[model samples]
Target: MSTTTAPAAGTSTTGGPFSWTDDGAAVTVTLDGVQVLTYTYAANDPQEESPRPYFHPVRTRTGDLVSAYRPHDHVWHKGIAWSLPHLGPDNFWGGPSYRRGQDYRWLPNNGAMRHRELGQATDDDGTFRFAHSLQWVTQQGSLVVEEERSFQVVPGTDSSYTLVFDTAMTNVSGEPIHIGSPTTEGRENAGYGGLFWRGPRSFAGGSIIGPGGATGEELRGQRAPWLSFVGQHDETCRFSTLVMVDDPGSEHPEPEWFARSEPFACMGPAPFFSQEVLFEAGTTLHYRYGVVIADGQSDAQRSEALALAARELLAATQGRNGQ
Candidate 1:
């Protein structure tokens, strides 16, 4: 299923150094004629999944697939998405909700983030950027939050690329909204929420890298400004590294990470890992992150260098926006 629309201003159809293809339902970014990533705003997922915008088919500079969608263990685990498992009494992360006493159960509180409008979109001079306005509504069709999301993909070295994601959400539910994760609901160290990523099955048993030369699942729930996962592809046995960096200016700076490489390779900065953040009725919350996707396994030194480069890029972007 797809939706079609007239191209918005600044939308490019001709190929150049970098280009964009907006097919209404989703948008794709390409570099030198190769796709880097695709963001799906109008998903055709089941309501039970609390459908929301996500980035899939994310690729390294060499075009190696690094993302997974609807994996068996978690059908709702899309490639890369800004998902929140707990929002007051609603569930926006999809699948079963983890109640403190009742364990996991399906509830009628699934909320969906529906794309409402497109904002500025540009593809020029080695840069590809886009923005979207969305409405977060509950299963019963009631507004909970108004959100604005933007993305910028930047070229790094020949073997790596960087993507910056920024989001601002305003509470419009008419009351305070509590945002949290399963860990806040009694599931220990299960703080799997916020900007999440699901890696391909071939990435299983990958290496997790963090600050201070940290390597392993022990970094889970640990505070860090950046984290990385190094995985080897199945067919060619080539390695790739993914690095995620949390903006120091975000609502939750240096967030605790929810990382794992045993059962599957996945990692993300969890803002509400162990606590709930209260969003007042008229308040807004913001978050920004930079991701570096490279074509080889990143050792401690390389991962740190790539993370620092991404941080500099994000800082420059924030400065340009006067944020």
Candidate 2:
């Protein structure tokens, strides 16, 4: 990874409504002096199972933390992370691996996705952009896959902001890599993998709104272009909204989403749910997603509007890429 001098404490610069500070281990983004997000790549705990890059304490514009990291119940879940439960013969989603008929079992095949390279951070037209190169290695330190991920943070309205996550991965083990979720291995309706998000305990009983007006557990196992979870952060009723939109250009444009409310809020857009996607040797696969963090409740109408906007943005980006 590249090395740079850590910025002094409390020393941050502003560009429009965004401010950021890099302390070598992580990059924190703030809005109007209020922290909104932190991208941690260095010094991650391997004991947590999947030592990978993740975004934690993702806060709304109003300063409410909507993202949770290393929750006691599911220590493997580290806020917003892109993970897969079953990757060929290795487990990268952490915890126990689900067997075909024997059910979940503890295995030593757990792997770690380590950050290997970091690109120079740049600010372009008020947007912050960065790139990362990571390697997925098993416990025995054998390479399974390599990924190039890019992140773009755009300042939105006073109450919201947008993050664009794009990843391109290649099979580096000289063999086919099979990507799947728990559901594909025998579990029913437990197709949770890929870009996952864990919410705070205060978000229990929160409402989940999707493009089809579905809510709560009913939203699980359903295909949707976008989904939003709105909840009160505390007794004071501080509302926060988290919206995730699947890119139409991705492998699975209409991916099934997994959502939960009890035992703490959590959700994910599982593209490889109930099935497996094979990545041939030396071949690459790309995926893109958009996340919106807002400081208010998102009703069905608002959620639909946001979804439409996200689709348009993705379409435009893809068009430019093709040109």
Candidate 3:
């Protein structure tokens, strides 16, 4: 379930500020000797529920937890995860499967993405690179898709850092796969899917800012190259900002970002959204996103700059391959 690796030559092996460690079930990243994030792949529930890989307890450099996991209201909502509410007949997004006329209902068609391999690669400067191979399988153990997901962590000043999520998936079911969200199945503006982040309770009053100065519900279901959600922890009164930059090279360049300020803090760029995307057999789809987490309140100008920088970086690194 887990693998350990010795730091390569010229790399610090004394529990430095940025490092990766695997403990069979999850790979954790630590900053300045404090845990910042954990990528968990192990399935720890019945019916194979909550089996998808996710980042939990994402923290600021100062050690403030910014992400939440398995909240009572939405047990299937993990901390930070990549999922689709509607993937053909399989529910990889957890909870109930949405049907066209039947609405949302618990179904045995819930699938799980099993982590197959974990590997680390060397990176320059203060960045770390790693990857994961996962299989999307149905409850009956039927294969639907295979994904190669990678992450690059770039540490910034103080508790600020950038986490890049690069994912490449191929349809291995010998048939076309239809990807969509709950909105496509009649849920209205609830078109949430893809890379999702759930913030802590303290982030309830956070402001969702997007490119061009869009905020709050106005930013939802709208296309944006990047978006930022800033809020403070109710208990700690400490502010934090989370910025997501969409890769212009992605198949869905202008993805409609799903942002929320009430109920709970959550947002992400939903590609399929209200529409459906078909992944033909033998075809691969690639997506790239940049996430910047910092300890501070939401600043429109600064967040816009951060998003632009992230977008440029993703464009340069991914090039045309991400398209």
In model 3, where is the ten-residue run with the lowest total lDDT? 3-12
- Candidate 3 lDDT, tens digit per residue, 127-231? 666676788888888998988888877776535888889888999999998999988888888899899999988788789988777677788899888899998
For model 1, which pairs clash? none
lDDT for each residue of candidate 2 in 171-224, tens digit (9 for 90 to 100)? 989998888888888789999888999998999889989877777788899998
**lDDT computed for candidate 2:** 0.79
> Could you say which candidate leads in lDDT?
1
Between prediction 1 and prediction 2, which has the larger TM-score? 1
Better of 1 and 3 by lDDT: 1
lDDT of each: 0.86, 0.79, 0.79
- Candidate 1, superposed: residue stretches over 4 Å from native: 1-16, 319-323
The 10 consecutive residues of candidate 2 with the worst lDDT sum are: 5-14
Candidate 2 Cα misplacement greater than 4 A, ranges: 1-15, 319-323
In angstroms, how far off is 220's CA in candidate 3? 1.1
Residue 5 Cα positional deviation in candidate 2, in Å, after optimal superposition: 8.6
- Whichever of 1 and 3 has more TM-score, that candidate is 1
